[model samples]
Target: MASSSKCAFLVFLCVIVLLAPSEVHAKSMAKAQGGWYLVEGLCSKFPDCNKHCKEQGFLGGQCLKLGVNMLCFCIHT
Candidate 1:
């Protein structure tokens, strides 16, 4: 009887271990994603601006001009 109980307990533990990864993955998928961080700097075209931002380890970037120089809002993930 004791051996049977131990076997049952081991099976339960194995099942839990098998199910745990899926639960963690599901939770992570369900959780809200992070927001974008804006990095302000001088820029020219949108492509060049975005490329520079990505090169700087950001997610992407966009150029918006306030005056003479187009301000590059580098998107940092």
Candidate 2:
């Protein structure tokens, strides 16, 4: 019974190892599909970021709070 449990654990570990690379690759692929750019200034509000991105000819923009800094990311197709 103990040997069977150990075998099951090993199988589970192997499955995780096999799936890890594909997951990482998928994330990278998604990032490559629609590019993201860091805007020049801090994002005080999402609407302002969106407007800025539109003016810059991007599809849209989002304001992300990283620590104390509010950063804007412009998205394009």
Candidate 3:
């Protein structure tokens, strides 16, 4: 009766707790692919840059420029 209902409720709560970690991991993956979400969400309140720093042509000089731009943009406004 009442005791069984309480047990069932406890089991439901335990199931929800078990599922919570998966939900958190999924959200983290989503954020990683979507953008620099956590940093922007916490700090200067925007995603840092759209440019990719690891591209091939960027090694010569372009990445340096992009990096500078990103730093300036992130720091100033």
Candidate 4:
């Protein structure tokens, strides 16, 4: 019974971890008044995306892995 409880707890924790990122992403998207911008160049790091977006007069940006591509999405208010 204890082992089963531990397994259930692990499953619940895994689900939370997986869903947390999406929830945060959705909230960020909602705050993007100027919408998302597809930044050109390789997004090897998150800070690189942020720097590019700031140069373009945006609030900030994030590096997202989309299938075969690592795309940069800039957000602005």
**lDDT, model 2:** 0.63
lDDT of 3 by residue, 1-77 (tens): 99999999999999998766433312111123324321112112223232322222221111112221322111111
Candidate 1 worst ten-residue window by lDDT: 23-32
Which ranges in model 1 have alpha carbons more than 4 Å from their true place? 1-34, 45-47
Question: On TM-score, who's better, 1 or 3?
Answer: 1
Model 2 spans > 4 angstroms off: 1-34, 45-47
Question: What would the per-residue lDDT of candidate 4 be over residues 1-77, giving only the tens digit for each residue?
Answer: 99999999999999998766433433233333446554443466455888888887887777777555566778765
What's model 1's TM-score?
Answer: 0.41
Q: Any idea what lDDT model 1 has?
A: 0.59
Superposition error at 54 for model 1 (Å):
0.6
Global Cα lDDT for candidate 3: 0.32
In candidate 3, stretches whose alpha carbon ends up further than 4 angstroms from where it belongs are: 25-77
**Reference-based lDDT, residue 66, model 2:** 44
Looking at candidate 3, what is the lDDT of residue 66?
22
Each model's C-alpha lDDT?
Answer: 0.59, 0.63, 0.32, 0.65
Colliding pairs, model 4: none
The per-candidate count of clashes, in order, stands at 0, 0, 0, 0
Candidate with better lDDT, 3 vs 4: 4
